[model samples]
Target: MSAMYGHRAKRFPKLPEHRRDQQIPDAFRTTMAGEYFMLGQSASRHILVLATSSNIRLMATRRTWALDGTFKIVPQWYQQLFTIHAFAAGKLLPLVYCLCTDKDIGTYGFKSQALIIRAAALEVDLNPDTNICDFETALIPAIQGYFPNARAVHRIAGELGLKTRYRQHEETRRKIRMLLATAFLPVPHVNTGVSLLEAGTTGTLAALFQYFRQEWMTDERLPLWNVHNIRTNNHLEGWHNRLNRKAGKSHNGLYELLQLLIAEQGVMDTLIQQVLSGNAAVGDLRRVNKVYAQKQRQVARYTGEYTNVRRTLKQFLEALIRVRAAMYGHRAKRFPRLSEHRHDLVLADQFKTTKSGEDFLLCQSNCRHILVFATGTNIRLLAACRTWGMDGTFKIVPQWYQQLFTIHAFVAGKLVPAVYCLCTGKDIGTYGYIFQALIDKAAVLEVDLNPDTIICDFETALIPAIRGYFPNTRVQGCYFHFCQAVHRKVGELGLKTRYRQHEETRRKIRMLLATAFLPVPHVNTGVSLLEAGTTGTLAALFQYFRQEWMTDERLPLWNVHSVNIRTNNHLEGWHNRLNRKAGKCHNGFYEQFHILIAEQGVMDTLIQQVLSGNVTVGDLRRVNRVYAQKQRRVAQYTGEYTNGRRTLEQFLAALMYLTPEPI
Candidate 1:
């Protein structure tokens, strides 16, 4: 606080109560404008005046009067010590000094008389252009009555010093603060901000609403605080503060004040020299600048839901910090303890229970930065399924995490999402950690977590990790993913335009793309694009096929005819829906937890519909009847029951046994 005030008062006026005012009438007798004290003559009060000199008053080129009143340094007989300063050369210098005995409306009427007498004594007209003050109700009317042409401008127009007598709850108080801050904004935005506050408020806030409307947003107060280029009253406040320290507090005696006035003559000489030498004293705005910068930073940090609430909370907490620091021995400057992200507050709690009253967050590893969310029911469904489908989406994933990965399985022939995890890496090791954790947790529920077949996209990292982690499960790469990989290669080799120009070329290229459906033994031969054409895309497609697809042992996984499902479309559909629900943009770390809990709600609903006995996949099963029959016949013809390879004659005979008449 001391540093914030800049220059301090070094000189003190050695004065006591009655002597300060009693000797004032005699003290100014030899000055440029003689002193006058009239008691009970002006009204029902005493008036003492030591007005500015005629020459100084005549120097008022700009007719702006800055008036203020203080009471602590006045004599016991006086009620208030008033000073009127005139603005000249961009500075406010004292023009008139008066001490009044009462605070009545009639007493203030006498202030007008004193100013009129001073103006007439200086041979200058009393009409002024503008009057600047702290907007004291009594003094304003008196200043206006005295100088009717002077436009009153109140410099105390900001929300910093607002005092409310009404009691309010915490949330209500915050709303009030925000509404009041609009006073410092541009005129157009002030009304809009107030209206937003009013729309969101009710009950006791209406009282606050009325208070703001009457006091802050009033027609007279608007221009003073608006971007109307009005100057602040810091200059007047600084002068009053310096005056208090020099007078040394309490009531002053006449003889002590006479000596003080004699000292003030020397003080004015030094001040006048400093001002004329282009070295006028300015108040310290460092503290004010820091606070305003902090406010702008907070505005940049929050948006939509947290913007207003975060501002209110940060201010309240900062005040609490100062109060606590002052009470204890801690430093007052060390305000607001920093912590993790704000949304972490709720996410840490969500680890206990979800919105649907279920244990939501199963496990979180801070070191690995992996979060795994799965309800017990979803785990059970995953354990019961013989086959699983997996997919990952980068779009809807939280900003804290890289991607959203989920495992889904067919339940009653309708695919249902079971487990979701947010892992730190797309590497094989990260996927290994995630799967190992899932396997351990599922074991606790007395369920076998391994699936017979795991269907997924052809992410190179994913395939190897699934094979390494779950050795027994057969990993089947999705047929659509396989085609997508080849499609990308076609574009890379610049064959897409040629493929599109000729429909026959397009058809042959797609057939080669669909070679993932052929059995591994014939997969290469089935994609022979040269048989269809010898030019353009056909020749390039075969070269890419032999170099990229044929060299991998995972070729068998892309054999769509051997898998229970040819594509992981269910998982992709789920990703699309989640991306839409979670919105287009990314989310925060804890925001993902909230979204996962929402996905938990989705699983909860899917489970309910599955058990409700109303929903069924009967039609879907019937549609796949012929495909199922074909799968069984192919299994027999392939001779999976015996280790020895079957002869072509024996395999055809076995295939004929399962191939009954079509009727």
Candidate 2:
């Protein structure tokens, strides 16, 4: 008996053994009324769309559409059963069903194209004013690509897990409802309403507002979700529930599901006929009437027809605040003034430790907050590295500090920040104190912090302080800063216009800066070549360069020949990243400290990954195409000079040609 039942089941229409098969039996390719149902299938058989002629005609007349996908009711060969529904005789009815092999943008694109092509063949316009769907990131762009004129409304509030939160807390429920009310606002006032609500929120509610801003308030999605009369795709969900109940089981056989869909189409045809002939009622009007009445009341309130005058966005927000106060009583202040003065504030215990609970705060005193943020492993890496980069950023420093000074070490080919100091002064005394603190901390950790080369800018006070602290260390000035100094001198001598318009003047000035790239012995000769026939602003520029940069004590500081890493650009880029993370200039002391702590946490993870051989750090900096080409030319010229093919004068001219504008 079991064998006979198996044979009978096999005789029934079955799905293809492989999903790659695109052929469909003729008997199952049409609806019960003999209307073609299998509209189209993709060439790869990854997507198949089905719709009858009458349903397509009905879909063409509707102005709104709701799309959704169901998984449980699909056959084993398919991933999901996707559906598109439209209003027919005042009821939402599924007009199209698609069997997709995958849930990606490409599959949806195929489905959209099939419908468009079929509609064009039947000469039925498929333009919709509004399309409703869930927040599937892949589906939104696919729908927009095929119907650019349609406004795609995403059901955000339903899917964000807000319903459970709303029912739990009264005050939170009121705030969440107010957030939903933003949908009813005029498109121009939506952002205003959100900002007003955001200002009044704090703690977890503030985080919720941030998420909303990031996900829904973007320019492309803002207009898509902000409709005056917002509608949801809840009706489509109900239709899926009905289809599941009719099927009686999950993962129904392909033939059985097709039969059920044909019967559904037949029922829809009869209902459509009944409503057209005036023999049956269209739909449940009570629920729709209630919705419309609520929308009208909201519109009347906004226009002041129900009261006195049109209300502003502020007035609407104030009304919500007043209602909340009436129901829940007055709330406390969101952000109270800090009790301690900005200069008196101290780091909390939590901020004193690294994310791994290691001691991170090396010293905190009245003069400076010297933070040596290296773990034991990081200290070892620092001791082993031969080069270091040091710089400070004043813009991101706390108001109580003069600058955020950072020390970076080259580790495994990547320049990683090793120490941070918040100093109250940019003087020799403050810098000396910072270095002393670092030395003391290194002594305690049993690691010596000595580097062979230190790269920095030509800060008048910083250079002298660095030399005094690390007398044996080699100090190399940034090559980019050298060019900037020469350009500034040119401007000071009132040669800005001549430098830009006169090619000879510009080349002479550039050659003066390009001497930094020459071999140490030849740099003076290169400068002397540029010194001949100099007068007026050009002579003054040369004198300034000699007095400031070429003195017996200053020559080696700026000359970068044979130096592997010339500029502190990697450190500068790190500072830029910190500025972006700080989000504003001169944040509060604790706020900036928190940002630093987060940065240390990231460094900790990276250190572990590096030690474990999971990550390989690349070049310290990335050079653009133009600068790379210039470097190639410089290399070629240097090679010629090394082989005695080119004279010193030719090398200087080639280097000058490659000099870029001050960066």
Candidate 3:
């Protein structure tokens, strides 16, 4: 029997099927099943008590059970018992062949039924009386029975006087360990420098000495050149370990797994594209030449005049190729393979519209120049201009490198240009790279750098380039650039005073500048000027040029007659107008550079009309006044100027008459 316990407790709880919910005496219900608390317990917890209360309940109604060659049919409560009986019987087959027949005190009685079931699942058995260890402890040895042939055959061969293969297996393991250790050692040094040796023998010591001596003898200035090399096997092992952790345990192989890793970290190709878009250098070739010059300066011995350094120069050229491949094609490995999607792609023939309504296309004909203009906008489209100083422009490199250095002028958080130079064959020398075929063909041409006038807001690099190329040109700093520089200087001085208070201080500085000889000691103190003839020098000149005429009395503001008078507010207002017209996100530097030129062209015409005193507010107000319901703000702000023929004495007398001295 299956160790039946508390028979009286099981038997005395029986109740007729129809009397399941009958109200019985409290004492009888509480005392039923030999437990006094049965009556107080909730119905859910009292299920086991109720099941034992009646035999008909155990055999109750039709409960669905389907057997498809898996197990014997049994009552719901007895199914587990039946399965245990079957398993126990199978394990003890060599010991017993008889099947249990009696229903009472029967059904595989005296068996450790739970143990038998577990043993069968694990494919192992233990004595019923002996307490077996837990599943975790016994699982490995128990599972070994499932593949019994491998174990049993080995045992049989050992008993039958046949030698075991254990020694041979150990030898194989030793060979594998030796191979791995050897592979872990450093390989022959490919490129010579500081290197880790597999064996620190006399040969390695001599080789290191030779390498240093060779470098010292060849390039005497740079004696200690540091070089490092990582073995491929070790590098690969580390990479694989990192990849496994990134992928987790779910990923099975490298093919799909690498894609996930690439996606997470971002593909080199996508990063290269991002860098290209921001780079103003990618389309300019002169920049590449400058880079070559810089490299030549650094390793002068390696790059001597033409012949002596030919091989070294070729090596450097190869390095440049590697850099360009990584930047343009996302090729890091020597054997570069582009995706089918990339290979199948065709160059986009369509043009992108810029903020100023100019159509822009990539200029592939010449990488050195960027073209910007609008069609039929002016006599000849004024081109946008910016130049790169290295191969990064023409040869191609990481887009990030380009983005870091590319200059874009923004006003009121919008893109703008300080100036646009319209160039032709007559001004080719003044406008660099305009002769290039792509710029010539472009509806809007872009001049790399203009020599005629140096803009105030020109890039730091462009400043020197302009000075070098156009020695005699009037390099005017834009009024905006001058103001910014002043503000920066003021901030550096820790002057916390507001701009209003600073106005007088600024005017005194500005007026002192107008006088050829500066009498202000404070302004000249610790200041340096290139030419002594100029009062305060270029620095003061730059400050005075940026004067805003609306409120500043320092310098005479822009007058129609003045050829090149400047106002900082003019460029600010002009940039604001362009941004208000086109406020969409900029797609790329090249496109924005072009749009700025087109906007400048329209603005130039407007400025010309205002300068000529011909711009009228009536026409603009008449059109938009209905909806806007307001007059147009004056298109221009001018100082009070009467046709002056009076002498300073007459002006002083009039001023004196208006207000006599306070005393």
User: Candidate 3 residues 1-663, lDDT tens each?
Assistant: 001212323433423222224233344332123322211112221111111111111111112111011111111112211111011100100011111112221222222232234345445443321111111222223323332221110000011111122123554333222222222112221222122221342443345335543632243212111111111122222233333344443222222322332343232223232333444233321224454445434334332432254543334333433433335332223223322232232323222333445443323212322332333222122223221111002111111112111222222222233223222122223234422332354334333323243333433444444455545544444533444444455444443242224553443333322221112232232122222344333344434434432123222111211222232334444433443333333223334344544555545554334335565655222432321221111111111112344332222222221111100
> TM-score winner among the candidates?
2
Per-residue accuracy of model 2 over 183-273 as CA lDDT, tens digit each: 7566777887788778878767888899888987888887777756555787888788778767866677777777778788777776555
Q: How many residue pairs clash in each candidate?
A: 8, 0, 17
lDDT of each: 0.60, 0.74, 0.28
Error of 2 at 352 (Å): 0.8
Model 1's C-alpha root-mean-square deviation from the true structure amounts to 33.5
Better of 1 and 3 by TM-score: 1
Tens-digit per-residue lDDT, 395-469, candidate 1: 767545788888888776667877788876898877887788788878898888888999888887999999988
What TM-score number comes out for model 3? 0.25
Ranking by TM-score: 2, 1, 3
TM-score of 2: 0.49
lDDT of 2: 0.74
Q: Rank the candidates by lDDT, best first.
A: 2, 1, 3
Worst 10 residues of 3 by lDDT: 152-161
